[model samples]
Target chain A: MEKKFEIKDLITVGVFSALYSIVMFAVACLGFIPILMVFMPLLCPLVAAIPLMLYFSKIKHFGMITITGTLIGILMFIIGHPYPILIFCIGAGLLTEVVLKMGNYQSIKHCVAASAVFSLWFLGMVIAFFFSFRDAYFASILDGYGQEYVDAMKSYTPTWVFFAMIIMCLVGGTVGGLLGAKVLKKHFRKAGMA
Target chain B: MEIGVCSNKNGAFIKLDPRSKLLLLITISIIMIGARTVEVEGVLRLICAAIPLVLLLSIREYKASFIYLLLLGSALICEKHIAPYTHGICNIVLMMICGLITRFVAGYMMGWYTVKSTSVSEFITAMERMHCPSFISIPMSVMFRYFPTLSEEYKSINDAKRMRELGHPFSQPLTYIEYILVPLMMSTVRIADELSAASLSKGLSAGEKRTHICEVSIRPLDVFAITGTMVMFVLFLVY
Candidate 1:
């Protein structure tokens, strides 16, 4: 019989996705600090890698990762992120799925690679700054934050910084992936769960 | 009908259809986020904030509503009074915290209310009525039901850690985190396996559509709430 996403696989996806989002939310709380906000793209992926790698190791199905990504996007929206994030996340999920497929879903190396790729979705959280609504967004920021704070934010996040953040995300993702794999081996593998 | 009455027991004053709660959630979230980008009037913001607060109060979630009011009051006060005095980093931190609270509180409260008020079966049935695929609805329902369970599992793990006399997290961060996460993952995965087995035996994976004993209908109050929210949303856009 052809393989399909049984209830078992879907439930597993839901559970792990919840775990990933909780970890992501914990890291996201750091964004309240303006300086830390700049590094969120890196920090989120680094912190979230353990859960993502563990989730990847358990799943042999094709669309499960994509579903997890979409679900996270929806959760982000629920928590007040822009709708454009959904597009970015879905794209990242698809890319991660493709990367995992290259290794036939079993290789530890591909799992690490996929983890790095999956972390790219953090880009969605900041893409709003590059949108045409920048002026309106900044205006809102001005109203909320003082003029000095807005100026500081503008200086902190120039156009190049967006690309720099992307690079940071990839690097952080790779490092996090390696760390996550080690953690998985030391713990889950020993338990025979992964 | 039995399940409907049972679920409505919590919110006896106003029984919103699950669809209305969903609509209320979307409206509140959009207004909250868009209010920052666009020049939404203060009156509209107040109304948006009030919608959830009033609903929460009506539902008898006194503690949550009280907390929401307290946070909103403090955020507004900090923005108006306290944030002006601070300089440099202090000013930035205070303003950012206030901005986040003011920006997100309404939407967050609305989401909390929706999730708290609606049961899993009702949510799935509502999605089914809206023609969402089972793939989306099933996992969403499971995710919603699992959050509290996750927190409960974490507490138990923490209790175990304390009993084991694990080193303080600050002293040995890696070991502490590993101890917490490894057991949490193991327990969560084990729970998922058991949940799946239980659900499968309950016919959750049955190819046919499932029926709910809970009644979900768009009553007059639902119409009132939906139209009220839509009007405010349109006003926020136009003005």
Candidate 2:
């Protein structure tokens, strides 16, 4: 059987991509708060799950997540995010699509699991931070400020921060998926998104 | 909160073909990311960072350009004076803030410049000419159209919510979710349906060669920008 996507499917993906980018952008802005920076990655996927589930309920098609993810990645890349982050995002999207497909895109368990998988994309930001930004970031600071500053910075920033971020994102994704299911059942389903 | 979509601003960067602009975006991003702590490398990075500002100034976007310049300046100052004394967690937080500003801000500003300047028709035409597959191009074009429409809808929703005095976002979390997200989702679904129907009626998925009125040829400025970016990219690679 030859598979074809209708115009509606493409439009749905496009609209969802916009929604996803806007939400992510809003979350990114919230991350400017120094205190919130660590928590944002953890909380973002949960916040995003609501829309993702709603989008899935409407489409329930294979490859939709991949399409939406790729578009969001391109949008992020165009906006100034590093290329590795884009690659990670698309890879996570593909994984989420596969997870959802295995469950035939219907079960809530699969949806939540898929959201959890999707949230792993946040790891790319951390990876980018360490690989692309860390050394230069510290060096630029040391050069501009002094050695005392660099020493003080190194003492405060434990090496575990990145590992902790990954754990938090996974937890957030799980919680977000559950919340999205609850919302879908209580509101979106009644509102006709389902 | 105005969503910054492309405006019909006349600038040297805006005059270049979208494909060339894309190439510049890639090359500059690589150079910026690969930048080192060495004085010469840092200077090169600074010059690269100034490209967006110069382009914005050429378009007479004085206010926006100034704001961006201010951000860059502040990031430098903060790194010098404030970041060193902050303790463990505070130090990390401060470092991330500075990193966001210094490392990511230029690319972000460049992105804003690109998106705000290039019109949708021009983008679609360029993508088509580049022989990009329809799957990518169609969704991309639709996505471009979607942002402005979504922004418009958000404004209307915000006004309605304000009139009804829905609880503030921070104070009433569930209410905020229920009122704001639900309405937004419903409308989004409706809008998506309508847009798809409208586009289909116009033969968007006809799977035939399409004609566009937008002329998308590369100018000399594009050649110059692309050449400059390529040279810098090669330099970064060598050194």
**Model 1 residue A74 lDDT?**
85
TM-score of model 2's chain A: 0.86
Worst 10 residues of 1 chain B by lDDT: B1-10
**Model-by-model DockQ, in order:** 0.60, 0.44
Docking class of 1: medium
lDDT of 2 by residue, A1-194 (tens): 12687778888888887887777677678876756766877878878877777877765667778877787778767655567778888899899998988888888898888888888888776664464467765664555445654675555456677788778878888888888888889876776667
- Tens-digit lDDT string for candidate 2 (B21-74): 787776656556557646666767877888888877766778999999999899
- True contacts reproduced, candidate 1: 0.49
- Candidate-wise lDDT, in order: 0.82, 0.75
lDDT minimum window of 10 residues, candidate 1 chain A: A128-137
TM-score of chain B of each: 0.91, 0.85
